[model samples]
Target: MVNDMDNIAGTLQQSLIQIITSVLTVIGVFILMLTISWKLTIIALVTIPLSILVVAFVAPTSQRLFGRQQAALGKINDQVEETYAAHTIVRTFNKEEDEEKEFNRRNHQYYQSAWKAQFFSSLMMPMMIFIRNVGYLVVAVVGAIQVIHGQITLGNVQAFLQYTNQFSQPIAQIANLSNTIQQTIASAERIFEVLDEPEMDDKIKETPVLAGKNLPKVEFKDIQFSYTDEPLIQDFNLKAPRDKMVAIVGPTSAGKTTIINLLERFYDPQGGHVYLDGQDIGSMTRDDLRKHIAIVLQDTWLFTGTIFENIKYGNENASDEEVYHAAKMARADAFIRELPDGYQTVPDESASNISQGQRQLLTIARAFLADPEILILDEATSSVDTRTEVLIQEAMNALQQERTSFVVAHRLSTIRKADQIVVVNHGKIIETGNHESLMNQKGFYAALYNSQFAGN
Candidate 1:
């Protein structure tokens, strides 16, 4: 709130300075006009004030038009960014011409709004000049009459003409200043809109102790959640023993990933509570809860860095030997050695230099180095080749030995060896058992499994 107040005060000060400077410049011009003839000074004073009044009346309308133009430009930028980010998807879906048309439509709208604003703003200067010129003509005629009648000297008439030019200068400056002030105001409003948005409450009130000697079980009791008003999961419950493998299987949008998000506290659940060793997850610091968990997402994201750096992201202080061991355990060492620079080879921006399988292996290596007590593998091997999948499976088997692991995958083959498989449908756990037991039940799990292995 204090920051907001400071920003508002700063903007007001700047705008006031601009307006005051413009008015002061006009007063300086009026002073020069007085050196002319008193008759011409009277004419100059009336015209200058009238021009200012006209501009003051028009300024608000011009601001509104300019604001609309700026908003249109912002929308065009958003569309361009979206189009570039989804360029591959757009091309794959043959949306090139369609996207081009949409872009053109938005571009045209921006052009129209910008041109309209310029049209109005441009009128101010020309209109001011025309009105000032008429006043100058009137002064010239009146001064000539006065000189002829011996009321004013010829030198005085010349001086009055010079003063008329001086007076017009400030009027022109004021018009430009008015336009600038409107633009500054428009920009401030947009900036403040973002600053005024509601931020998520991220403060932590307490910290939990995490150590090798005392690891606690994770429990979910009567948990319900939703991204919107409609609940995704209701009355959901689960308990993960300190060191056990729990595989959650579900069809698309059955809320499998939502559980992982809840566990990580990316979002708080709408109802019930998540407990870690009987302590509410919300009550504990978010960082403390996440320190014990290591997740390998399906869509692996590799920063533009060497394989060694990417893996070391999990633990910045990890020793070189620990990093090498983790890579070897994930079966990523073989590929790293094949590269020209081995572990030092820099990855491309989108990691296009490496195969999808290699990228997944690198992510897995990162998780291994973190040495987290709780592991989450979300479709970890879905994008890899069969041979690579088998290698990762072996690595995962070794890594899952002492940690509580949660595996979420659509590939039925991957979780066959899991200690327990919980089948979920419509955000509810419809079946829970081992591979053979779930198959014997002959429900959703059996049908899904049969559909995949029927040809085999």
Candidate 2:
């Protein structure tokens, strides 16, 4: 599988050049051989179909074997990735030998399938050579009889022999690349599948929403969306005016994140529209729309780069002082300074170099540097302790002071001060009000809040 990917870069280059040059050579030589002797030309032409029949018979078996080999390789890769990610757990449980045995089993399966694919494909070239050799024998016997009758000159027979070799040469080359052709066909199939997929339609992109507004009110009007057979959001509606913190509290898979996906245009509603400043969001360039919004999700994504670079990523033009101030606001500056190179330290891809709480802090700091007009905090403080969450809440309050914000929280305590708290159950809104109003009403929000404080 590694070899397949390594060769992917050059597969088209070598195969195309070989096929084109070979085809052109065959065409030129074919006409010349015909003029030498129709009898000999017919013999060469017969070999063409015979060569094709050989490939047609052998190539499918090779392709099937290749597919099996790839699947086996994928399984081995999955096992290796799992072992690598959980190497510490394996050592803790003393399961390293067991893991090695499973890995060896998958490796052996891959070896068997890979050899079979190669062995079947390898038979094509030898069969092609045999076909051409038989054509050689036929040409020699027939040309000799014709030469004896002086029907064609000795030079013509000699030239025809040369033509015969040339005619079969391309066929031989193509046959030798049967395995490559099969792999190319398989790769092309997968690529075409993606290319043929449905894409977003933007008929209104010519005219944008929010032409002059840096910040616009967001609205979901009669929204209907679904991922599976049933609709997740049926007749959903909401209006979030500018400079207000709207908190959405719900149980797991209550469509909290799905709402975020719609706001960011990751998935368009199956029906109805999401509007910004009274205009449909579909009317704006998605990139232009997203530039005004900043999101800090629960899963903090930190790439392999310096801390300074990661902070600067939210706004490349941000001044060094701006990055420091943002970090301070998010309360990430203290731990960052404790690092060896501070802002210059490079983290691993998984960001395992830092604790999960620190990773969340850096992400929040990065979002602060963006200074966007709209903000999304999707369980942004979930990884932190209660004390740290309280600290981050202060930073979030400062960030949301003059921007429209949406906060999805599982912990009921985080949204106590929000201007409006929305309670979601299943796929629909169950309650909507402030912390005071919802508590006064004694509804779902009150129940949820009471459950949190029950022990106390």
Give each model a TM-score.
Answer: 0.77, 0.86
In terms of lDDT, the poorest run of 10 residues in model 1 is 1-10
lDDT of 2 by residue, 176-281 (tens): 8878887666555444566789877655544345456554488887888899988798888887878999999988888999999999999888887888776788
lDDT of candidate 1 over 47-86, digit per residue (tens): 8677878788778888888777777877887878888988
Minimal lDDT window, size 10, model 2: 207-216
Best by lDDT: 2
Off by over 4 Å in 2: 1-7, 24-39, 60-65, 88-116, 151-163, 205-216
Residue 325 Cα positional deviation in candidate 1, in Å, after optimal superposition: 2.6
Off by over 4 Å in 1: 1-60, 74-94, 127-192, 203-216
